[model samples]
Target: MAEEQLVTFGLGTEEFGVDIMLVQEIIRIPPITRVPKAPDYVEGVINLRGNVIPVVSLRTRFGMERVEESDLSRIIVLQVQNKVFGIRVDAVTEVLRLDTESIEPPPPVALGMDSHFIRGVGKIGERLLILLNLDNIMGGEINHESA
Candidate 1:
């Protein structure tokens, strides 16, 4: 089987990536219809064409500093198993292919932060990106009260 490239986006200065197969589309941040009693990590649901899809802020989920929404903000729709969710990224970057040998084990700090969510780390040029296990990252409950 051919190895697939990973698609990544920026959250602040940090870059986060996921398997290309999981991403359905990337769009500009839109007005999200807030869902009552939903988790804080979930920005809320948006009408993607006619379907209602939940949007999540990866920054909030990973305990990163907040960012103001701008043109750069983008929604990366992903299919985590059967459920499809939209991830709010600071910005979407280019797609890059890395041979399997280029991926390394995630560091202890990244692993400790819900270790299961991090699949591995990939070095592209001089920059390093953490590849996320979307299934694990989106599996937990999100606290809406904090949102």
Candidate 2:
């Protein structure tokens, strides 16, 4: 049997996963040039090898209280909507595989927020894997009124 591809990461205690193929690379949070009218969740933009890439703070995007970026914080650069953006995470765990049979839908209440961001949940050993939907992760929740 072949193992499934799962890129694991975390925020405080909650763990998340994304398809490894979509992930470009992981780097420590770097200086971001703030955009004047960008959405609040859009942290700003960073220059990667001279190519400007927009960045998003998962903390801000998730409706959670923003925490200080510590030593372990990382920017998981992903290619979404034909654009490259870095999604901040506490720390990246490891890439593993879980069969489709192991994935499940999120429960009714994920703290009152929409559960659409979660792609699927995979029970791995003792921890539940919160697979993230990169497509809808930073796309749908954007507030134009506040921008």
Candidate with top lDDT is 2
Task: For candidate 1, write residues 1-147 as lDDT tens digits.
Answer: 345498988987778788999899999887889989887787789999899999888888887878789888899998876678899998899898877777888887874366677888888889988889887656564223443
How many clashes does each candidate structure show, in the order listed?
A: 2, 1
Candidate 1 residue spans exceeding 4 A from truth: 141-147
**How far is each candidate from the true structure, as Cα RMSD in Å?**
5.3, 4.5
Reference-based TM-score of each model: 0.89, 0.88
lDDT of 2 by residue, 13-118 (tens): 7888999888999999899999998989899999999989888988888888899888989999998656688999989999998887888787777644568787
